[model samples]
Target chain A: MTEVLSGLPAALGVESLLAMLAGTLAGIAVGAIPGLTATLAMALLLPFTYTMDPLQSLGMMAGIYNGAMYGGAIPAILARIPGTPSAVATVFDGFPLAQSGRAKFALHVALVSSAAGSFLSAVALMLLAPPLVEFALQFGPAEYFWVAVFGLTSVSLLLAGAPAKGLASALIGIAIGLVGMDMITGAERLVFGVRHVAGGIDLAVLLTGLFAVPPALAMLSATGKHAEGLGMTGPGIKVRQALGFARTWLRSGLIGVTVGVMPGAGGNFAGILGYSEEKRAARDDSMFGKGDPRGVAASECANNADNASSLIPTLALGVPGNSVAALMMGAMLIQGLNPGPALFSQHGDVVYGFMWQMLFTALLMLTLGFAGAKVFVHMLRIPSALLAPMILVVCLLGTYASTNSLGDIWLMLAFGGLAFMLSRAGYPIAPIVLGAILGPMAESSFRQALLISQGDPLRFVSSPISVVLVIAIVTVATLPLGRILWRRLRARDARRAEHPPPLRKDR
Target chain B: MSTPPYHGAQVGAGERLLVHAAVAALGGAVLWDSFSQQGASAYFPTAIGCGLILLSAVSALKVVPRRLLTSEATLVKGLGGLALLAVFALLAGEAGFLSTALLFIPAMALLGGDRNVPRVALATVSFVALAYVVFHVVFAQSFPPEFILGGR
Candidate 1:
């Protein structure tokens, strides 16, 4: 505690505070832009942080994390396009609210809910992280392996529309992860004699290319020209109104927090769940989907709550809950801060300092979010023709900065092309990105567990955690199959019901 | 003016064929390499390679019933952009940062169907100049000097 307090001055110093402010502002802009996600923003800013103090860097990154989640609502409300995947649910009601000339009301709802969610989650992180980490410290290699398996399985099952494609993409990601030199053995396994490939592709460059560039290219191809005519002209919903909405839909916020904490589920899911719950419970349910402030509040609160709570698993177990958490882990590693149980013990100051920074940053995000709403709404007026090229240039520069290697640039282009192709084919890009992020962890842990068991397959089910994980993997893998079967049976029953006369004649 | 149902079926077939071939070749390469490795490296890659081949085959088969090429214009643009990217990668080392970026950015914009030549040129120059300043001057990071343009 003393160490945490002593580190506070350094963490909250003038320079650090200013950096946090700048980062929050930048994150808002980046997250508001379509095709520019929080992950990209974090990756782009990471190289700049190489020279800064660790605490200051962490503070800035935290600010970006919090602000970007809030920023996602900007575009969703204004353009009807989700700035981040997490804001997909926000578009359901947010855009309608904007179209109804209540852009300010929707923005206000987003702001208030985001602040509430972030504040609550920050408190959760501060209070719960220590104990969780202590508990997770008991996990061995087998348990860790199970945890990774569980994470991957849950994400694959819940996120992917097609189970086969998700598994296939994940398998491909694991293969790509195996391209570099082997960790236990110094031998290069799949480098194909290329020296640059020996380092493997950096996750940042890959992510930036996969998620950012392809979408930018696709946007260039999309020719729908709708001028953004958003104005700040509706009945300005006061804080009291927003709070009233929150008071009525408090259960939705709790649902958001709970969903946010669940492994593999993210803000997008939480938002959707909260919105549905709120609508179901509302007296005037018809107001939803047509533009309602309560609808915006429910989604905004849940999405932001999910954003903050998703960090819980990442910080405690070293298993990221989502892509953003994974990116945060990357940033933490780049700053020489190891994640997991030992992180709190060895770097409590940095960890706790980050928690405090997140709290303040959330407050800063709320202020900036509301003040900059009009500006963000106006930014949608920028022509995609101009924006797309600029995004590509930034992506190129960011990729080059990661390694200063031209090889990486080529790799980015290749992956960008592949992603473009895959997306056009109706394959979900999220699974691929998530797979890339988690693949290495899964493979290394699996291999380590295998080695410990002397290649015995049953050893994976030896521990209690491993057994639970295996069960989870089976459940996740089979759930979709079960659902399909149930649907088919239901359809058959309906057919039988319709053809009762023919069945009676056959009998 | 309704279009034919299988208007793009030929393209789908071609894509499926190409993907299957690539998958098979890549899988074989991976299998050969993995088998040459010392220990469990062989198992993982072989498994992954086989999985990839199977998935690609499945993906290809799935596409056979539907239109593979969504838009002819997009296909041409995608291929052209890919070619431009390849050119940029090849020249980035030899032509160095500014020269290569000058060529790459405009070419990409043009290929992407931007007809505003002046805007494209200005964007290219500004981006190259800003990149040079940031990478070379501000950061003092050294990049490969221009070889074709004769700068050291």
Candidate 2:
């Protein structure tokens, strides 16, 4: 602990501080822009960091990592579009809050929750890196498969009223994810010989099409007179109301840190799981998908909490948990610093400084977010007609810029159209995204586990972690049925109470 | 009478049935494709296909009251907006992002009933410039060349 504090002085240096601020600001911008991602921004910055001192480069990357996670919520709250994939869960309640004229309040909740989560994650990363990395290493292929399955089942709550449609949507996503070359056999499985089919559908393109375009279409559907700025000047949430969500923040923070430490999972998965778990734990989940602040708190908190903890595996065991962590590892390698225990022993000051930078950057993000939010909320003031087109333009430009592929743009439009139809048909969209993200993870791990066990189906439950995950999956999968059975029993009891003939029926 | 229980979309039983049928057909198609594949590659698709079929069947058996997902007027307008987006995508490569966006913004604004042409034009120009600065200059990302603007 003292060693960690000793590094703080170096992290607080002027150059390092400036770099951190710049990265955080850039991260927020990139994250807030539809189709632009923190991974892309970090990848772009990786080369330039080669010449800088290790602390400066690491500080900057940490700032961006935390900042982008929070920045994604801005678009999610003000517009229905999630700026980053992790912010997808935030859209469940944040956008509704915006629609109900609580945009400021939602943004504030997201910002605070994000800071709280990131701080907790950074603290966990500092204190528990070795142990968490050891626990993460315990996950074998079978366990990873079960983890993916658990992730899929946990978010079933998002399906809520339309379980069947939601399940179908998830299946559809899995099917889409199945398109292109088979990862294991290198065979063309589902390609219909379309151009770029071999490369598979990009998740970014899918997300942009599914989440961003539909809102624009909805805007065009409305009449000229908008909802008078969607309550732009409405009262913000009170501190007391915000404090009510502290428990949610803490729980989501734990979920995020745990997921982050595990390989093959990322912030998006953590955020969704946190939101679902929050809904499940709530006494009344009726307001969950309808602009509940707890939903925003859980989602934002979990995603930001994922930021620093994701690097625990990378720094401790040289295993990058996610793409952002992989890039950070690359940055470290470029600085001639190899990750693992040797890194701590050899470069204690720099590594611990990096950890300090993560904590400080999170605090910096909270301040900057609040300052910028006042300006961002004015997005509501734009006439819906203009706002709609502007969003369309941003989506089009952002999609095109992502890969410079015209086909991807066309593909996005197709997904957008499909999403528009599915949403109108009353399907939950989040599960589809979840399915697409988890399908490949689940399938590959399942296949690997099978190969390892010589095709034994029981291999899935051979490990303790796998057994726990399997139980969790079964419980989550049956939650809807449990609710249905409970409802029926309650209704029957109500009926018996209504008519005293029920007493005679007992005889 | 008390309100009918509804979750997301409120549509006629026929529409719901049609959607379920479509889902079932999609599942069948996927299942059929999986039969020709080999090894672990086929396992996931097969599972997803079967799940889809079963879920759609169960959903078809459930009773739900009929309601409108959106008003007819709004539906027409929304479809129009989608059509415009399709047109924009097709033309973007040929006309370039700037030229295409220049035309798309005004068309979409007008379609959305924004009759203020000057305001629309200003917004269009400003957005184009901002995009150019951010995407082209800061990011150095390349876009399709504009024949209309001398290969911008």
Worst 10 residues of 1 chain A by lDDT: A220-229
> Candidate 2 residues A170-225, lDDT tens each?
78878887888888888876666685867888666776677667766766655565
lDDT of 1 by residue, A285-377 (tens): 887888877778887777777766778888888877676777777678768876788888888877877777877888889888877777766
- Model 2 agreement with the true structure over B1-152: per-residue lDDT tens digits: 11111112245667667778788888888898899789778888899889989988987888466665632124455678888888988898888877888898999999988898898999999988887787678876778886555364
Estimate the TM-score of every prediction. Answer: 0.88, 0.70
TM-score of chain B of each: 0.74, 0.76
The deviation in Å at residue B83 for candidate 1 is: 2.6
- Given candidate 2, what's the lDDT at residue A248? 95
Clash pairs, model 2 backbone: B10-B67
Model 1 whole-model lDDT (C-alpha atoms): 0.71
